[model samples]
Target: MFPDHTSTHADTAIAPGDDTEHHEGNPRPRAMTSTAEIDSTISHPGSVRINVKGAFIVDSTEQPATPANGNSTVNGSYHEGKDIRLPNHTAVVSHIAVDIGGSLAKLVYFSREAHSTEPGGRLNFHSFETDRIDDCIDFMRHLKDNQLALNGSKPKDLCIMATGGGAFKYHDKIKKALGVDVLREDEMACLIIGLDFFITEIPREVFTYSETEPMQFVEPQADIYPYMLVNIGSGVSILKVSGPKKYERVGGTSLGGGTLWGLLSLLTPANSFDDMLEMAAQGDNAKVDMLVGDIYGTDYNKIGLKSTAIASSFGKVFRMKREAEDEAEDNANVAQDHPQLDQKVHASSNNATSSSQPRGLNDMSSRFSASDVSRSLLYAISNNIGQIAYLHSHIHDLSHIYFGGSFIRGHPQTMNTLSYAIKFWSKGQKQAYFLRHEGYLGAVGAFLNRQPQNWGRRGSFEGDGAALEDRLRARTSEH
Candidate 1:
């Protein structure tokens, strides 16, 4: 849960300094031009005018172009060398949208081009920890100020579209900080809309991950209906999406990303979620988890369970602790009965090197390394989510299941576990899909809410979508 009111003292700004260099030509005076003049200008090759709401002006003879590196150079300044590419021409920042979840706040905004043929500008993505709401507000304030300086006047329609629980919780703070109206949209609806845009419009946005072939792109299907969306955030929500803006939250679980995070915070030395993930990556879950082989001495072929399959998460640790406690108790009894022998043993143990001495129950980290604990907990959470998601898909008879939300973070182990769960549960009849920008779905959906409902199918908006797809594909190929 988020606090109703933000703290009086703002958190330190986490954004780095602007290091992007800028080059600008002489500013051209603004003069209104007739539609005929705009038509005639278009007739001439390489000449275009800035068209704003039927008003046209020749800003430059040549159209401004985005750099080949997919970095936007807007208003004489680059986007701090970020990979974000906006429309060719510079425009005002009219609107911003945010999806503030329990853990993270994702933001999406657009800089409309003043002199471009495209209808929609490129979307920029940014996020911050929920605890750092002040920092996020600062970033938004900077963006609004920058736009005000460029256009010399604020757009009357400027507003912040927000979703998630934090929208209502942080509404007053955001409005007071930025002096902009906050519009709250339904959280689930925004997620579906955002996902629909990416899967339908953006090329290579959706993909499948596996151990054999990681990040294999899945082309947008012609009939992408009735699919299951398992959004793993602080909690998990499984929805059955039948069409655009048509979805229902059928099932969910509390054992989600938050579960792993809370457990790791108490059990491991990981200071952050990424740190826990990194620790888990190097860990051997077999050390702390009970496997099928441990229980059966071989694979449970009757039920098709493999030898390496996890029998119980942290199951080995429980048994190990009990055995250690019983041994310690036995040692205490022997020491009470045979004091001389116990003294010799104690002296020998004290004389031995620290590495040679057995780790006690108090030193759980030494007995069961933090890495192994992290790995086991990660598997436990991922496996539980995957199984529940699969069950929902099965109940609805939906074959295509997509996992989204901040929890995945495109981490291989997380994806692999989820994918493997679906495969194991459905006997390879179902597959799990992922997204490149999985975490920003709600933010994007809220951004798109500013546009007309049918914008995706409109001619100009379709053209913009194609352009964005091309840009994203180009960036992907370069990497």
Candidate 2:
């Protein structure tokens, strides 16, 4: 069983029948004897070592093969291993931690070797849309049933850690579906924990993104304190972190991924979030947005505003619509005033309209390109988030800002806009950082919550292997 705690930061107590022994001056419990030699060098992101039959098995395989069930793959594969044991030698055959948001439900779980009681296994990451909650449940059920069949017995414990708003919203659904108590962790706490682990323990985890240089990995800072974490999901949350568990909700905005998604869904024919992003990638926001040049006919040098800078998102559409309406009205008046000339005027109008139609809001497909609309909204949202994040950082005087959440999805335009905003507002003083596994922060944090504190420090396994093995044996004796 996992450590029992009253709260996320509360002191944890070892569960009954646990093999670990507490040591004075050491936060993590140690095993009586070392049964395995842990290695920290793993060629994977967020890789951690766990004792497995006195051996360490690192998952070095590429992306897992997609399931035939048509479930989308995010980071980790589901069909990598059949029988994976939960860490810490508990009787829990299926262990999973989820971060369910307004849009996406991210999952982090361990998949171990088949029919093996080994602790070492692959840590897999997956995500599903919140609207499609059944798919996520089905995937979890698949993992549970597969483990049951391979182990030939029902698990004594089924551990499920959850976070985010959907953790409570979908708590009963998950518990009733999986038949296990859903352990809820604080969303903000999990986000900080997950982010701290990645920045400190995982190499090449944090990087800077910009249009000039797409991604440049940043080395872990020697002392990473007084930084800001801007998590952009359905909404935005800006946090000021002073230490590992010390943070405060500084500022945020409701204009985030949901705003873009909602606007795009209504304005365009995009079927999914990814589709909208694809449309954005192929779009030119200038076509839909009103720029400084559109307003001033040139850059406002006195105010330092570039001509190409966006003055208003979708601002030109209004004027274009008015012009189109006026032309249509005038044409109708002319046709009414002159009966014989009506056919000639109508034919000329048809030819002129066919030759060059004014870009307006009247025609859905012709005037407003889905790509242009998608790109404009994407820029609007990203720019707003970036500016707000910079403001929080400035007020708090935090130089380092890390951006996380599913909204990013490592999209080039989104990252570029965010990075540019930070640079422009801060005059190149403050930097915006991004994570490789940005979307799974909460999920990974929940996953780590099940393990001992500092269990995955520096990507090396530090625990009592003898105690783990003994616990594994004791659990097997019952079945």
My TM-score estimates for the predictions, one after another, are 0.71, 0.73
Model 1 clash pairs?
A: none
* lDDT score for candidate 1 against the true structure: 0.67
Query: lDDT by residue for model 2 over 207-323, one digit each (tens)?
Result: 898767877877644357768999999999999988656789998999988888898999999867777888998999898899999889999999788999999988988877777
* All candidates: CA RMSD (Å): 15.0, 9.6
Candidate 1, residue 358: the lDDT equals 39
- Model 2 reaches what TM-score against the true structure? 0.73
Query: Which candidate should be chosen as best, given TM-score against the real structure?
Result: 2
Off by over 4 Å in 2: 1-94, 113-120, 148-156, 338-365, 451-479
Worst 10 residues of 1 by lDDT: 6-15
Report the CA-based lDDT of candidate 2 relative to the real structure.
0.68
lDDT of 1 by residue, 1-479 (tens): 00112111111000111122111111223234344544433233110111112112112212111122123222212121121233332433467889999987888765544565564344566777787788889888887776654333374456788999999999999999888888898899889877875665455568888888876877644357768999999999999997645689999999988888899999988866667877887899999999999999999999999999999999998888887777666766776788788667767765442322333544545778888898899999999999999999999999999999988876788899999999999999998999877888898778666532222222322235544232222112111
Give the range of the ten consecutive residues with the poorest summed lDDT in model 2.
39-48
